[model samples]
Target: MSDVDAVRLDLNNPVFQRDLHGLQKVERHAALDTLAKLRQPNWQQVYRDKGLHWEKIVSIKPPPGIAALCSVRITQTRRAVAYRDGAFIRLLAIPSDHDATYGKK
Candidate 1:
């Protein structure tokens, strides 16, 4: 639906919504703030943001229908897993720890 290449976030996934709500208020806010910042950049900028740490999940096989699974820092200490669907970053999870984000499942 987007003509521009700017990054867009898809937080509508049921698991994503659940995981986000599971965070403590402060952490949730931090994640939201990070999401806001993320939406401001194009994919190239996001890939270059050291703090975002955008990386492909090589440790786990991506589910069918997705090109690749990726993780990005959503808060100071939390990383969320997602896959790019067009211009949208479809966030799928906010793991409890860093390793869980891309660790073997």
Candidate 2:
């Protein structure tokens, strides 16, 4: 919605998608609310490195010729969202294990 290229979901990472999708059942407004707050002017600065884990939500893009991978960092509880870029994409959830070594809090 911020016009920053559509949010990419990596299907290869089923864990991440499953987690994010689960959130929808609990509170559809949760992630959307959090993301909306982060979309304000200078929002990046506010959420730059404010995620719960030892890691932060990284801003990424695919390099030339190479396909991108899904990567998500739960800004609230250190959850992960797995996804890739391109039409007819494969988006899925990535389990926390994949990110265990990255941002450990």
Candidate 3:
């Protein structure tokens, strides 16, 4: 992601804060861990030539309206992508189910 393309999280946005806070909760720690793996060099490849790539979407569960597109951070940048109305909200940080699906069997 380019510096200009970098998401500027509105700290004042309640929905953004709420979702970010939810990600910090103890129950979601595993998700946070999965996000960490995504931040690696190999994982950061998707951001090179393409703005969005299929491999970056690690896993997904659906309500059809909401979705979690788990992707890695290339720099020290952190951001999230939530699906809404056929588009991404581009929130704070990507959610994950790492402990549940990344390596556990």
Candidate 2 lDDT score at position 55: 30
* Candidate structures ordered by lDDT, highest first: 1, 2, 3
Estimate, for each residue in 1-105, the C-alpha lDDT of model 1 and write its tens digit.
245777888899898899999999999999999889888557888889898889999988888999999998999889999999888899999999788897854
TM-score for each prediction?
0.91, 0.34, 0.28
lDDT of 3 by residue, 71-98 (tens): 4331222344433222223333343443
Stretches of candidate 2 above 4 Å error? 1-19, 47-75, 81-105
Query: Which window of 10 residues has the lowest lDDT sum in candidate 1?
Result: 1-10
State the local distance difference test value for candidate 3. 0.39
Which candidate number maximizes lDDT? 1
Error of 1 at 47 (Å): 0.7
Instruction: RMSD for all candidates, in order, please.
Output: 2.1, 7.1, 8.9
Q: How many backbone clashes does candidate 2 have?
A: 21
Q: Indicate the residue-level lDDT of 27 in model 2.
A: 46
Off by over 4 Å in 3: 1-15, 18-56, 66-79, 84-105
